[model samples]
Target: MCAVEDHPHGTEEWWDRLGAVLFGPWAPQAQPGSGHVHCEPDWSWTLVLSDYDLWCVLGGIGRARLNGQDFTVTSGCVLMLRPGDEIEVRHDPANPLTVGYQHYTHGAEHRSATVADTCPPHFLPPRHVRLDDLSEVRRHLDGLARLRRRPGPDTRARVTAALAVLLLEIHAQAARGTGALPPLMDRRIHDVVEWLARHPTLRLGLHDAAASADLSADQFSRLFRRETGQSLREYQVAVRIRRACELLAESRMTVRQVAAALGYSDHHLFTRQFKDRTGTPPGAWRRSV
Candidate 1:
């Protein structure tokens, strides 16, 4: 057996660090010039990026050359490029490209750190992943674009959370092709997660969730744990707690109101759960934030 310490930028320590930071309290700040761009018919440019760049093709056809590899960029196509990657981009004259792009940086931009370092962890999205259905991905991109135009009190937190989700979706899409699990099963697990996130307040039972995934309850339980490392019930609780945090931080809602909104009949239970997960009661958490 051999120990390989020199991991690449998107592997080993890089992935671990990215996962921690994105899931933790830190938010990646989009540089001043980050946003969507509509490329003209004759538009073409080449540049070496200095930080992380997320590029999504909202519409139209384009050609991109990244590190000497050419890509035909179409709608639903996503690309995550890192520092010093030379990229050349252009679009068709008849249909101009509407591109949603963001330039941001997480701390683990280099490959120097060893796997044992306690840097913030992040999930590294593939360099390219073409989604079969762009509806959901486009929704997030549109939300991001709109958020930029209408900044609000919770804009930073919302942006960070949304980007985290966007990356997860991209990683799931990439996983469809490369993961050891069957693609359909892997996709079903992610779909269930998305459905749960969308309906955070719903008190769905295990059977209902299994039905949504088109699997038996026992099967869904096993696979969900295998894929996500958490039981179905635990994930649901996490969803509620995450939403509770948002409500407490962003709105004038009292802790009781927040608990009620999340389908908690007894506010005390909510407080206990919040404390168990966050090391503080809801009120204290709200006050700290």
Candidate 2:
């Protein structure tokens, strides 16, 4: 069964003020393959990050049930699961399981569970990031573990800062959404995708998206979904919506300006699409959040 403990420090309130709090950084976590399964609602959250859990698998593999769906996770896979999500990891005897995890809260307030802590209302982090290369993650975790164990007047503060940096790094990678896997892309397409992410407002014709992959429109469409779990149009919309949310929540920009900044062509399209994803009109969503 997963362990539950009290907050490590005096007050979790500081997390809200600072946009992040990291606790329980456990690395090189392994479980004996005894075929034991833990089943419980077993969800946890604090007012700080609003109940989300971030965990990583560093080695081995195991069968897991997240909100009732069974799947497998292997080394270098990271998950930011919902606060109320029910999960169970079935210890596999053959390979065992090695895991690393930390609980954290992000965002200025509990308006949402978005990674940047910028989304209003509420949002969950991506399903997972399958890291073919784990060097960066390894460094962060190793440093966090080492820094946290030393005793000093500044030890806790230093650990907290390191944790914040680590969380941001993970979020940056998670920002890729369906396009997180760099190794899976052809060089030309990878460069194009990188450019697109940097300029979310850039409008591209269907042919342009296809040409980036050096494939026919149909082939590109199929491959994009297969690799990213979203269609071309849906992915583009996601990028724009994220930018819109950031501008609205963090800037003095008006709704119209936000829409324009995102290259929406018009507010009507932006409002409709924003509402479709966020379940509220842009103005209303901004106000409520």
Candidate 3:
């Protein structure tokens, strides 16, 4: 239930603020300079750079010639250039392009390469992935901008960690090809989950509930984890433990009766699992409550 924060992308100052928060000294500069170049491409121009850079295409679609091959560049397309690599931007004569450039140096240089190489080749589909949706990327760019505005050690470490996670997520998404969820297999899993919630006294198992989903045991296990972020067994155990705590607090049921009520034939096993999860034995927990 966490809401996403919106940060506008316009002007060097806005980019600069983002850089300060995300990257240290690798944020893009608004003005063209020795390490920076701003060109309004008329038709096409080849770019030869000394340092590795990440280009964010703010407007217009074009193509680039990297190394010895050609690649298309469009809005939301991020082009990463290695040092000494040659690239060409072919823009429409009528509509030129305005690109945002940021060069990373030393540690940032290696970090940028490592991140790009880790991402899957088809992470973003041909025309669907928008660069603006990448908040972590924006964060890294912003962190770099901040470092340029004011340098510090703490900021650098923060930028490194953020960049690493961003790269990992991008790589994972690319490997996955698409970011869409599979269609639900009806509400069998939901029914099973609700059953566990309502009848905390029942000892649940894969076979016990597999028929409800009409799923094979293995399939059910995998789907449960994917949907609930926890294994089915884990979720069941959690529910039982919670009910145990409630019974211990509200009822005068002895530990043995509580264990039997929760479908645990062996009181000792129940006590062990309870202690392992709650850091105290059921008897101790009951007394404390």
Candidate 4:
């Protein structure tokens, strides 16, 4: 019917309440659903959901009716269905849908209905978004699957943390109110950002990045700053530092090695830059993590 039904999770208050619980002591438990599904042509889905469900399309096309509202489903699309909502899904037989899904909820047992409305707007996140890079999100989904299969309190904790991170990532990618970049510009900038994020070690100068985007240096710089709120060099530095932090925390690499891997020829220079951005040396940050 393409009409959105009234549901608690569809409102800002519901998100606010959930946000409070998420950041509070009694955080929601993350339960991984069926990993990736290669749907058969005859397959269909319908449910009156009892928990928060996240569905990410991996491939193929489909149509979903959430609480009677229709949505076109395609690769990279993500849908968030909440308690008390109804969903029906079907796909084309020529190219059946493939999807990854997970569930999140409060308490040991799943709720039978929606919570009462009495919350804030601060926790409102996008209910749907088509990510520019799905692989990164896919990694988190797969990690959740792996963690859920393991038997340990530690793994369960990690699953919850991973779910939180995935939500935050979606929030960051979602467009907020007013003054978004034009679609073409947004896509171009997205490509640049994805490239920089994927190759933090590569030294891509401002002019080169501009050329890659088929724009003059000044034009590209202005557009990039307008779209991302950061200059090209600043963004690149931030990307490199973020990767450095990950390596320092998760890998056996020494600080010098990390610096070198990120294209910092001088280890001292990397340390100085890292300290300027993080207020501590890489080693200290690693230890704290």
Candidate 5:
């Protein structure tokens, strides 16, 4: 029941009130830092990420509490406090607590002072989870904060692009947290991951991957899933899709050639799978990129 009041003041001060004001010591001075905040919320926030709120903690550490979950945070720990999940705070007065945060909408046209926004009032992620060592994530929030305040031709597009990176980070982390890849994961699985990524055309099955780790097929399947948090089938599909994107965007390959490179014999099936996962057909997606 010990909750911190929402301190919007530090964020404003941290980001120079999102205006032409000179940067404070806490914020970046020259690089025109990503449109993010370097805030010391002296009080703990009862709310974390709303359906419209996305946050990242860059420095300091604390414990975030949801209804049935808790997180030990450090510089790179990202929190997913889906709608309605309350992340209460308890900080040491002697040490102080500071967090890097950015709040924006996900195509949800809602505004402050109204809960009747278009998006769900409270949307929880598949689970309340913590992703670690996400170095690429913090900058997007900075970009979000920066673009939201500027006016130009591509402000909306810029903001949308930044938001995609942030959300993708969250979803990827959440997927990894699914007991398939515990925070303290095994080393062998890391090797398998490297192999799988490097040999996207190998078309691995449970036994084939397990053999790389000296494990039997059944043993490999269980341990691999337990260690990576994804079934062999699921993991391979993801790898294929990722490689497909790369070949499509960066190479002179047709969808059929790309599919063949990823071990998909049927280009039509590959197209269907790619569309299902990315919401865009392979050819169209490549063109846009």
Candidate 6:
């Protein structure tokens, strides 16, 4: 389940309060586990992590330094930092900030459960979403907490599904409210382009390219154009044409042979694509060059 707390980490008193809230009345938690204290040049802060928890910064404008990268957190942004990850939360002292966080942690049995090696690492893409009421999120967290408190054969499965749903919701919200393309888009698209360049003659599909980039087909298409200024189809055709030109210039292969080598089923179709791109058919273009 999700638990939320509104506490500032600007003072020692606040840190003590936060420690009590995160570690429970039974034990005093420390950094790299339930809570941490960081003193930066301009500000000081505290970070709290629940066991296998999902956290949401309900209200505040701050930056989270995770894995040496900064993520901006404002109202309505939810962050799920996996166990053992480091997060620092600093507030603007001039404004005397108020920050809210929703926490979720798994039970003892599920706490040791590792996401399948096959499961893809979760990525928090950049987005701009206005903060709305978070009652629904709170409810989900409550349900999650209840499920965690109970241990059974079905407990682990239920918790996993709940976490999946929470992650999907976060992704959907970020996608819907965004001013910038996620950094993941650029990295993923670059991988796709590189893969195509390395294997131009291999038969590739839209799905294949998307998978290589670790994105859904539609997401990859939109972000690919936004990042590279070219549609995936356009990019694929350009790669094929470039490869075909290299073959035409470097090899003594016939047009049909080149087309087949480039995964084109019809020689005429390949010629049409080449002519459209170069303003000349394959043979004429080769002769002219």
Estimate every model's Cα lDDT from 0 to 1.
0.74, 0.60, 0.59, 0.74, 0.59, 0.57
Candidate 3 TM-score versus the reference = 0.40
Model 3, 65-87: lDDT tens digits are 66676666665565655456687
Candidate 6 residues 39-131, lDDT tens each? 233674555433333455544467767655676665555655555666676655543233333334432322233431112222322222332
Deviation (Å) of 87 in candidate 3 = 0.7
Write model 2 residue lDDT over 1-289, tens digit each, in one string. 0111111221234334324333222111111111112222332212322354556777666767666566777777776654456766655565665665665444433234445333322223354555544557767877866665576898655755676666545644554333332334545556656777898988777788888768899887777777778887888898889888888899999999999888877789999999999999989989987
Q: At residue 225, give the lDDT of candidate 3.
A: 82
Error of 2 at 37 (Å): 17
The digit string of per-residue lDDT tens for model 5 on 150-226 reads 76998755655555556545544554455332354566787888888898888776766787889888888888888
lDDT of 1 by residue, 42-137 (tens): 888788977667888889998888888887888877777767779898888898888888877653324332321222323445577776556677
Lowest lDDT 10-residue stretch of candidate 2: 27-36
Candidate 2's C-alpha lDDT?
0.60
Residue runs of model 4 more than 4 Å from their true location after superposition: 1-20, 107-133, 174-207, 211-222, 225-289
Tens-digit lDDT string for candidate 4 (99-177):
9988876443333323312113234344556766578789988888887778696976677777777775554444322
Residue 119 C-alpha lDDT in model 2: 33
Instruction: Compute each candidate's TM-score over C-alphas.
Output: 0.52, 0.41, 0.40, 0.58, 0.42, 0.37
Model 4 poorest ten-residue lDDT run: 1-10
* Candidate 6 residue pairs that clash: 1-141, 1-144, 1-145, 2-141, 53-104
